[model samples]
Target: MAIMLSGHVIGLLKEYMQDLVEQARQETSAQERFGFAATVYRPDHAISDLLALLDDRIESEGMQVGLPEGFLHEIWSLCNQASVHVADRVYVESNVGSEAGSKARTRELTYRALLAFIEARGRASAQGEQGVMES
Candidate 1:
C-alpha cells in the first residue's frame, strides 16, 4: 500500500523543495558569473538534499509541526521508490526541451516529478481502499 501523508507534511516538503531550488538557482548564477561550475548536480543530489532537510526538520521540530511518527522513514521509502522515476523524468525534461537548462531548472523538474509521483501514489492508494470497501 502507498503511504499516506498529511497536507501539512506535503506543505513542508514543498517548502523544502523550493529552498533547494532557490539554492540551485544561486549556485547556477554564480557559476555563470564566475565561469566555473561547482560539482555536478543531479536529481539524485536534489533528492538527497531533500532527505537531509527532512531529517533535520524531524529532529528539530517534528512534533511542533505535527509530523506523524515514522514520517521520516515513510518519506525516505517514498523517495527511494520514486528516485529512478524522478531522475528519468528530470533527465528527459532537461534534455528534451529547446530551452537551455540550468541547475535551478533541473531542481524544479526533479521536485515536480517527485511531487507528481507522491500525488499519484496517494490517488492509487485511495482508489485501492475504495475498491476494497466496495468488494
Candidate 2:
C-alpha cells in the first residue's frame, strides 16, 4: 500500500533531505535494487510561467516592502525568456522520472535548473525575511 503526502510537505522534505535523496538517486541497483523509500510526487503535463508567479509574489511583497519598478522590469526581462524555465523543467521532471523519459538527459538538466532555482529562492526568501525581522 502506498500513502500520498501533500505537495507542501514533500517540498519541505525534499528541501531537508536533499543530500540523502541524492545519495539514493546515485546508489546502484545490483544487490538490493536501487529504489526510493520516498519520492516527491510530481504531476503531469503542466504548463505554467513561474516568472509570472514570482512577479506576483514579489509585487505582493512589495506592497509592504516597496520594490522599485526598474527592479521588477529587470527581473521580468531576465525570466521572460523563450526557453523553458526551471519551473517548467521541474514540472516536466515530475511527470517524467528523473532518469527515464523521452528526453531524459534534457529533463535531468531541467531538474537541475529547477533545483538551482529552488536553492536560490530559499536563500533569497530567507534573507528577505531576515531583513524584515532586522528592520
lDDT tens per residue, model 2, 32-109:
364433333231211122334345655666445434445445434433331356557665655566554322233344
Candidate 1 structure quality by residue, lDDT tens digits, 3-115: 58878889988988999889888887888799985566788887888889889988999899888888888988998999999999998988888866677787799999999
TM per candidate comes to: 0.90, 0.31
Q: Which residue pairs collide in model 1, if any? A: none
Residue 89, model 2, lDDT? 67
lDDT value, residue 122 of candidate 1: 93
lDDT of each: 0.86, 0.43
lDDT for model 1 = 0.86
Best by TM-score: 1
Assess candidate 1 and give its TM-score to the true structure.
0.90
Extract clashing residue pairs from model 2.
29-34
Each prediction's RMSD to truth: 1.6, 14.5
The segments of candidate 2 whose C-alpha lies over 4 angstroms from its true place after superposition are: 1-84, 87-102
